[model samples]
Target chain A: MDLGSINPILLVASIMVSATPILLAAIGEMVVEKSGVLNLGVEGMMITGAVVGFAVAVNTGSPVLGFAAAALASAVLSLSFGVLTQVFLSNQVATGLGLTLVGLGLSALIGKPYEGMKSPTLPKLDIPLLGDLPVLGRMLFSHDIMVYLSLALVAAVWAFLKFTRAGLILRAVGESHDAAHALGYKVVRIRLMAIFFGGACAGLGGAYLSLVRVPQWTEGMTAGAGWIALAIVVFASWRAGRVLIGAYLFGGVTVLQLNLQAAGARVPVELLSTSPYLITILVLVLISARGIHGAPACLGRPFHASS
Target chain B: MIRLEKRPQPSQLWTVLTPVLAVLLTMLVGGIMFAFLGTDPLEAIRTIFWDPLFNPQFAGFTRPQLLVKAGPLILIAIGLSIGFRAGIWNIGAEGQYIMGAICGAGAGLAFYPADSVLIFPLMILCGALGGFAWAMIPALLKVRFGTNEILVSLMLVYVAENLLASVASNLLRNPEGMGFPGSRNFKQWPAAHNAELISGTGMHWGVAFAFIAVILAYVLMSRHIQGFNIRLTGEAPRAARFAGVNPARIVILCLGISGALAGMAGLFEVTGPAGQISIDFNSGYGFTAIIVAFLGRLHPVGILLAGLLMALTYIGGELAQLMLGVPGAAIQLFQGMLLFFLLATDVFTNFRLSLGRKEPA
Candidate 1:
């Protein structure tokens, strides 16, 4: 029950690490949704990335190769989803759920040999000047590169959606695929790209779990993180900056819960563990109740050029 | 170049053919996958699709287990089909299932050491109500706040899992069994056990309920006004609204039905085969039922057949794992492939591929 045992600096530092996966996933999904596509296979993609990343890192002894392979594998996996939904015009929700099932099964099959195996983890990058700073350096500058990369990605996504014509076109495609197609834009192709990008980001997030966070391979390791990321997208109202805040807020809750458990708080362990999911649900309710649902108009709609 | 043209109406022929086609496609692709895993492809496929039902050594025991496995799947899928028909996604049936088992089992356990016939019926009622109430959360939110039921329902699964662990370890721990994290075995309590009505046939109360649900669902979908409304809502929401269909009522009704069925399935499992409320009582029946609902074309009869087919995969997958050294996860991958192929082939239902170049507009 002694709350003083919890280190504030370490808590902030760990929040960055904890939030990286969801941040990466949410940002990518944001892009995909912005392009008027909803790919609910984030969990599947992330888990695939986790296993592939772990296997590659273990075999090659290189975390970088592991991350790249994970991104590629998930991107390829997402293409299957893109093809089914975009090219074949399958129902997006069902196809996405199928993708998740496939990912879970495939990852488990591939991860069988790698169970309990440890992989090379990502190295932390300490900013030369900032590393020596008082509390700020310890809180932010000393985290792993993925944490920074995820933050940079949020900023990049914000800029891309805000200042870029291609981003606008992507948004246009998402808002009304028919309009985009009539304007001579390849709606399906753009959606496929966005789906691919989403998969890659989900992969990086999953790889972060196995290679950096957990630092070991376990079956079903991503364990609802992808779903949380999806909830974060809704909580953020599909805005990039709010997505960052949502991820950090979720990360803060997760870290705080774990810290409470470690500090032997009076709350039951199960309640503490369940807090993150409950918090996500609460945030979703609060956000949705505000009626600020900025979901893309064409989200989850199958695109067929022929109408 | 090939071109797809939308059919004036959905093809009934393709509707019946897709599931069969999807199964064959799964066997072919799954065989190749098995081959890569160093198992004999034909042997693995045969073992998965054939051995469980036909192998003389195992068929005697596996035959009845098929009913045991399919019973819950059919029940849950029947519920999900209703919601899916109205374009309402209640993806968190797994959570509802857990809650149902908890409430049903807890109710029965409260009357522990008492010999009363009413206990079992009361448990059933509690189980169904438990699931229905759990489902109402997402339904109410969606109706009131415009919340996405898919995400909310899915999120609740995690919450439910945690709650399950908590109850199993703390609230319902078997006191007489040296502090183990499970309730008293229902098998030992004849009053609460959902035992097989026809011994050795695996026909329990759950299986009976599943059959009843199939006929009921079939009637509801084909012969009822509510069915028409559900279909209309899915196909044309605006038209449905114009026809005086209350969208909120439909959402609530659909979610409630699915949740109750899923919950009943869970209660039946915990009482019958599982024999107790444990942390891992749910075997992903809720999620797998989603695939069942889709594969059956959201039709009750289709779901019944699909449920049995999926049940065969489960039994066969286990047999394959034991006999051919196939990894257990391969079966999950196989099921996933079935859904993927089904969705891919479903394109034929509404569109026909033209082999020639498209006509100029």
Candidate 2:
């Protein structure tokens, strides 16, 4: 029952690390959705990135290369999904589920040799002036490069969607692919690019998990984080700024639950562990109940042009 | 350059041919994958696709095991196919399955040491109800609030897993087992055990129910107005709305049926084959059923055949692992490839390949 043992500083620092993966994934998925493509295979791409990232880091003794390899491998994997759903005009929901199956199975096969293996973890990058400060420095300034990169990514996505013409076209494509097609915009090409970007971002997030978060390779390690990211996208209403808030909110719940267990709180361990998922469902219900349905109209619809 | 032209209507020939084509394509590609893995591709392929039911050494035991494996898959997929037909996705059947097993097992355990004839039937009812209740969360939410059922249902899977872990360890733990986390074995409890009706045939109550479900689903989809409504809703929602189809009722019905079936599958597995409720009791039957539903083309008879084929792979994959040391994950990869090829080839059903540049209409 001793709640005082939980340090706010360590909690805040860990929240940044824990939130970074989902933040990266959610922001990327937001862009993809904005382009009117719903790629539900974030879990699949993330797991692929995790295994590739870990394998590369272990072999090369470099986390950066691991991250790059993860992004490349996941982006390549996502293109298969792109080809299937975009070109073949397959049902996006079913195809996305198939991608997850493929990714999970493929990652398991590729990760066999690396099971129970450790990888080179990203070192903390302490900002100069801020790192010297008291509580705020320890909480925010002292973190890995991925944490800051994830934040910058959110801001960058926000600006891109708000001010850029390309972003507007992407949005137009998402809102109504047929209308975008009538405007002579390459709807399929734009969607494919968005899907690729989403895959790469999901991969980087997964790489951060293996290379920095857990610092090891484990089968099925992503373990529904990708789904959580997808939920966060809905929770954010596809806005990049709110995506950051949603990821942090989820991350805070996760970290707090772990801290409670560590401190031997009276609450049952299972209850604490299940809180994040339940909270996500609660948040989704609340958001949807507000009647602010901001989803792209063309989301999850197959596009085929015949002129 | 190659181009695709939309057909006036979907081809009936391709509808039946695509699954066959997808299987062959998977075998070819999967063989190459096996070759890269250092196993003799032909041997691995034979072991996976042939040896389970044909090999003299394994057929006697594996034949019955096929029914045992396929029973839950077919039952769950039957329910899922109905929902999928109506375009209502209840991906959280896994959670419902878990809840069903827990509730069914818990109900049976409540009457421990009592040899009543009613125990097993009561358990089945409880199991279905548990699953139905679990599914109602997403169904109710989607109906009332316009929430995304996919995300909500998926999140519940994790929650269900945690609940399973908790109950297996604490609430349902066998008191006399001295520290092991599991329920009392149902096999030893005669009144509650879902035993095979015929010895050595693997024809348990679950298998019997699955067969019944297949026939019932076939009737419902082909000869019933509700089935017509479900199909109409998916094909043309605005048309369905104009025709006075109650979309909310359809959502509730689809989710409810799927959840209940998935739950019963879990209950049957726990009582018959699984023997006891444990932390790892689920074993992905709910998720794999999704693949079975798709591979069967969301049709009842198709799901029956698809379920059997999928079960053969499960048994054959085990045999392959034992005989050739092929990694267990290879079978999963194979199934995934099958789906991909099916989806890829599905284009032929709606479009024809044009070899030359498009002509003015």
Candidate 3:
């Protein structure tokens, strides 16, 4: 096989695009989990956002509105999860799975008519001088607005968690919910807000898929992206910057597998298709070696106001 | 001010009543969903919950199928309940099930066209081993590195599906057939087939195994030191450690046993009703077993009954598909409502739900 058959530069560029949704979703989930709540409904919220985003964009011919609608829909769904698990003190695992089922069903119903509809095209933002640079330009500067936004979000989240009062309060709640409750913080309210933000982020990620990547609505289209994002949260040790890195790494693996198949690699198509999942597991196993640093201490624990 | 008052001991009444309460709540919510779907809510509810077991036109077929469907679910759920009791969530039973089917089918096909008695036993062993080995990945990782087993196990499912496809399309493709992506029909293989032990009733070796699992699980949970340790670790980890229960060993053992049982269920299905391994060999039994485990209250007898109830929904869902043209997703939502309500109503287990009086400011 010719070495020239594959362009390394294009490979890197495409991998970044592929990783954008995961990065966005993971970053959002990182913040949510950091705020003393484990919202396992990312998959459900993402899919809902995907179809809602697609339908709105297709109807209004505005990608911005599509993204906004996706975030809003996902945020609303996330709020349901937050209210149930936080206020009613339902088991998070069961509620999360239910959310996924409901999301899949709801998306199918809403997306029924838009089954074959195409999405509005997102405008590409090419850096004037940087995009024209020989090799690095294709590797980094040339991408849709979402790619940059994902990276920017990572930085923003990193700063917020590291420096801000709100971030500190969120972390305090996550670390010791009882202590935070004793200290007079509105633990449930903060968590609900965090869950909403996480849902909105996941929605944006889902919208990116239907509105930009695939640019079409299909039933179950967000296909395990939510789960992958969850894994990324773990892989990143619940750190925002690490989540960005993990998302990109996963994205690279996905792109690499597809590219390998396209380039007629010796591996079977199914093996190539399964590579992304296998890689995610392997990466997670490796990251586990570093220990669960930055993991919120109080995740998944139901907060009862009284002892 | 109102507070969540602690009972001297958790109420046993709430324990038994939770599932019933959950079912009622699901019926109410699910009935509204059916109404939204434009079907007669009452008729839809009856079709889903009542008609499958009693309607003469359907009961004959559905009744026997219940045992067949419940067999794997009960077997898998029994294994998962062990892990759940030890506070380990083995969410990747689906992947383990697939691996077991693949490994078991692979073993049976390795001795293809042979009419020997050892083939079925060998298949069962390989299936369990395959599932166990696949499960060990997360268990070992969790023990060694303290990784989150939930994500690791669940993610492996996609990997296992790809492996199934690879094997079916290539290595396991029947030579006699013209390039079909599946193994030689297990039913046609006299020794490998898990044929019905009771004729026309659909009762097979798997159902027998499920019953045996329930008895063994009941004994283990009630009369064994390991069972006590598991319960202690789940309910009070610090106390369990102080009492000399090794947490690491428990995690590995719990995950290992669950994975093996899940794998066996997969193996049995592939050889018996499913007939062979195909790309779509899995029917999401692994995922559904979680619901069964919880619905059964993580008790062996409870799981047996819960498995049957869940199996009823599968049969009824199929009937709904045929009779009402309702999409399969609606059925998924219907089943999902059970768990949603189950978790929601579990609140009453620890807290009373009486309305609190508002004091004037």
Candidate 4:
């Protein structure tokens, strides 16, 4: 009931922190989708990244190495998906689901020994003069390395998709893979690369959850963040900037729900907790009703070369 | 250079043999994985695939336990296979299952201390309806707005899990049990209890329903118009449309049947083996059903066999954990491999793999 109890600065900071993982994952998935590939194993890849990141950091005493290990391990795992969908011409949807189940199970298996273990903390990057600013500085400037990197990644993707020839080729492949193949663009190869990039990004997001958010190894800790990130890609209409907005919006709901619980609001805690997912679905449905603008035409379709 | 040449028609032999091949590949690969984990590969595989059904020491209990474990999986998988066949992916059957359990348990709890002959049937109806309503969210959204059902349904599972936790803690908490977060044990409620119909055979109402579903589904797919339309839609959407088959009706029918079946599964589990509504009531039956459906080639009979096989793994997984200290997650990884290997080898059904220079376009 007390609006004054909530701090705007802290809320902004929390939103940034909360949104980082999804932003990273969605951004990567956006690239993959742009190349006309739909890899639904974000959850699996993220959880794999999470456990690997946590285990490496704890054992190596280096958070940076943990993040690297996460990216590498998840990317390696994603290659199987690439081989299945791209090379074997398996159904993309089924393969993605397999990736998720395998990733979850594999993460759980490997994470067993590391359960209850604490991870090395990732240091926040406090820019010299801006860190002292009352609101704007704390809201935007003060964050860990990954948050800033994620923001830069958004900009880089936007530019790449708009300007770079490689990005154009990716988009070309996504829009019409058969046409792209006719033009000698190597549709499968491009998609394979995009899938790997998505895997790495998903891994980083998982690493963020383990290294920064929870700072512990637990089974299913990434929860449904991977799915939410997938939804964000749709909600954003495959736009980079909109992805940032969507992630923050979703993150705000998550933070607001927890804030409601902390403030002892009259609403049931479970209802508040589910608000993020409900809102995502609502937004997704509303947008899709009107129809999407930039969805990859070949999204989720498996590519086979020989006719 | 290897090239895949599309066959004139999908090889029918591979269709039957692929599942068998996938199982063998999974066993070989999974055995190697177990070996890496320091367990004897053969012993691990034997324990997981063999011990539960034939081991003299465990058979007395494990034999009957297979049906108990397979009932929910078969029921849910059968439901999912219907939707998946029509390309209407309802990945959130887990959520529907949870809602069904909650709603069914809530319905039964409302008439607590006032037993009636009608209570059990009413619970079944409510449970199925509960799941139906829950599933309608994605169905309606997909129908009305063209939203993707996969993400929406799957996301709802987390929401349902939270709701489950909340309900178990607050609304359904057993009042007489000193503040425990569970409902009244329905096993003790004679009118509500889903007791085993056959002595020591684990033939509860759920198992019977699973069998009934298989028979009905088999009949429907082979002889019914709706079943033909379902298959037609999956194989050729444009042709189905050309034949005046209503896509919207198919979506609703598929999602509805799957949701209702999943709901019933949840209700049976809550009332029978589980015996109460608790926070941890869901043991991933919904998720596991997806694997079962795929493993069974989305066929009713295949799902029945796949469900039993999956259940065997579950029972054997427990045995592995007990005997060799193998982690539970490893067993899950092994089960997931079944689906991965299935899909991987499925390539041979439609195209033959050849090693040569890439075929000229």
Best model per DockQ: 1
Where does candidate 2 clash, by residue pair?
A: A36-A174
Error of 3 at B246 (Å): 1.5
Clashes of 1: 2
What is the lDDT, from 0 to 100, of the residue B339 in candidate 3?
78
The residue pairs in collision within model 3 are none
From the highest DockQ down, the ranking of the candidates is 1, 4, 2, 3
Which pairs, if any, clash in model 4?
A: none
Instruction: After superposing candidate 4 on the true structure, give the runs of residues whose Cα lies further than 4 Å from its correct spot.
Output: B355-361
lDDT of each: 0.93, 0.92, 0.87, 0.91
Better of 2 and 4 by DockQ: 4
How far residue B250's Cα lies from its native spot in candidate 4, in Å, is 0.6
- What 10-residue stretch in candidate 2 chain B is worst by lDDT? B352-361
- Kindly report which residue stretches of model 3 are placed more than 4 angstroms away from their true locations once superposed: A126-139, B1-6, B354-361
Give the Cα-based TM-score of candidate 1 against the true structure: 0.99
DockQ of 1: 0.90
In candidate 2, which residue ranges exceed 4 Å CA deviation? none
User: By lDDT, who's the top model here?
Assistant: 1
**Each model's DockQ?**
0.90, 0.80, 0.64, 0.84
Q: lDDT tens digits, residues B1-361, model 2?
A: 7888889999989888888899899999999999999999999989988887888987888888989999999999999999999999888889999999999999999988799999999999999999999999999999999888899988999999999999999999998779799999999989999998998878899999999999999999999999999999998999999999999999999999999998899999999999999999898888889888988989899899999999988998899889899999998889888888988998899988989867786
**Cα lDDT, model 4, residue A26:** 92
What is the RMSD of candidate 3? 2.3
